[model samples]
Target: MPLQFQDRVVLITGAGSGIGRATAVKMASLGASLALCDINYDNLESTSKLCGATTPKHLDDVDVSSNQEVRKFVDATATKLGRIDHVFNCAGVNPTSIPLEDTTDEYWDKLVNTNLKGVFNVTRAAIPHLKSGASIVNVSSISGLRGSAQQAVYCTTKYGLIGFSKCMALELGPRGIRTNVVCPGYIDTPTNAGIVKGGEAVERMVNGNALGRLGTPEDVADVVAFLFGEESRYMNGSVVEIDGGIKGTVLGGQERAKL
Candidate 1:
């Protein structure tokens, strides 16, 4: 009747906030044992407290960018939880919008390391501990599907992540470990809150979608949960967009209406 993850272990990166925090809560509510990590220990602690006393949880301050940190966390999770059933690579960064020419080497590396290579690091470390029926959901962005002004580096990382996930899916498919990607647009979380400029920009983003509203972290989290669970067992190497129907066209009349 309900989504069931009882006795299953879920390893989540960037679990301190945004979609990662929301997914941790969702998995915990479904009775999953969680291994949660974020670069910020204080925020990670807050997320752990939000998961409540009932959820079996392990907390770590981990920068997903570091292969060493990721490997240590992955090993610790396997040791503490015994096995890993699902992985949500929700750790990422959105840099300030800037001209491509003005983008600094440091800025480029920061986004690439955290957004793309970070997923690679975690996935590589977690793979050995995963077995049949294990699921992996990498959080991407709609920017990866298309492109955006002033988001070159961020978009590049996300696009690369999609490709990487697809390869993993094909490679892990025979082994029965499914890999998928989630592309979320205009999610109104602390992550986006830091970037959205003014009320006008917010209004434009809200109206740009068929839903005419910003999506919550919970919205994306729901889809991630489905991908992790048996409900989406047949899905692999799938790239799902969690946008609120942004710029989607409806097929009907000569002048296509927006969906």
Candidate 2:
């Protein structure tokens, strides 16, 4: 059966690339109205166009770290759209390998602000506008569950998302607002375009998982769509892992060196 999200207003951050872009298209195909946000204007507009959305306004330069900005963005989206049903927090950064000892204050702050606090700011602003039974999906990573060398900052932010989602689920479930985390494995997108630029990351992902290949944005988007629809009405406060089951692969080995 086709999943219908007709007229449902979905606000998605990081709508310019990767899983976020895929999710926007998927929902839009199902007739969902969308408010797409991203720091990259061109790609964000491209995604909106691909969805064939009318009134697809783009918001570039949103600093998710600032509560004021987050509130303003949500208010603006809601004012423009009139209603909000689903919110996807997907903007994030995975900087190059840098030792924790060598990590600077600026580097760490940006990561934390965008990754962890970013989700918090957006979700917090949208909560009041969310109708009962509305859903919030936070984009987390397997890095939160497990760790990687030289990725202390990334790990911390993702792990924090998991914790934040669970608490929101608990606090808002009674109001019929569902909160959940979508923890995707390695997915090919512009964020990690550097890795596949040389074909090295693809090779590691192919050998690292039970699926024997890297995950496409559509793969993750399918899961996200389910969470946003009636199919998952009873699912909340859950951490759904979408990796190829590479939980035990050797850290930084050839299995997932690309990540």
**Poorest 10 consecutive residues of model 2 by lDDT?**
250-259
lDDT of each: 0.85, 0.80
lDDT tens per residue, model 1, 99-166: 89999999999989999999999999999999999999998888778776776787788899999999
Query: Residue 245, candidate 2: how far off, in angstroms?
Result: 1.5
Among the numbered candidates, top lDDT falls to 1
Give TM-scores for every candidate, taking all chains together and pairing residue i with residue i.
0.93, 0.92
Q: Once superposed on the true structure, which residue ranges of model 1 sit more than 4 Å away at CA?
A: 1-3, 194-196, 248-259
Q: Clashes per prediction?
A: 0, 1
Q: Give candidate 2's total backbone clashes.
A: 1
Indicate the TM-score of model 2. 0.92
Best by TM-score: 1
Off by over 4 Å in 2: 1-3, 53-60, 250-259
Residue 144, candidate 2: C-alpha displacement in angstroms: 1.0
RMSD over all Cα atoms, model 1: 5.4
Report the C-alpha lDDT of model 2 over 1-259, residue by residue, as the tens digit. 4538776789998888888889899888877878787777888878878887463453555767888877888898888878889999988876556788999999999999898888888988998899986999998887778887887887788888899999999999999999989887777665564344546556766667788877888998989999988889999999998888874733442223212
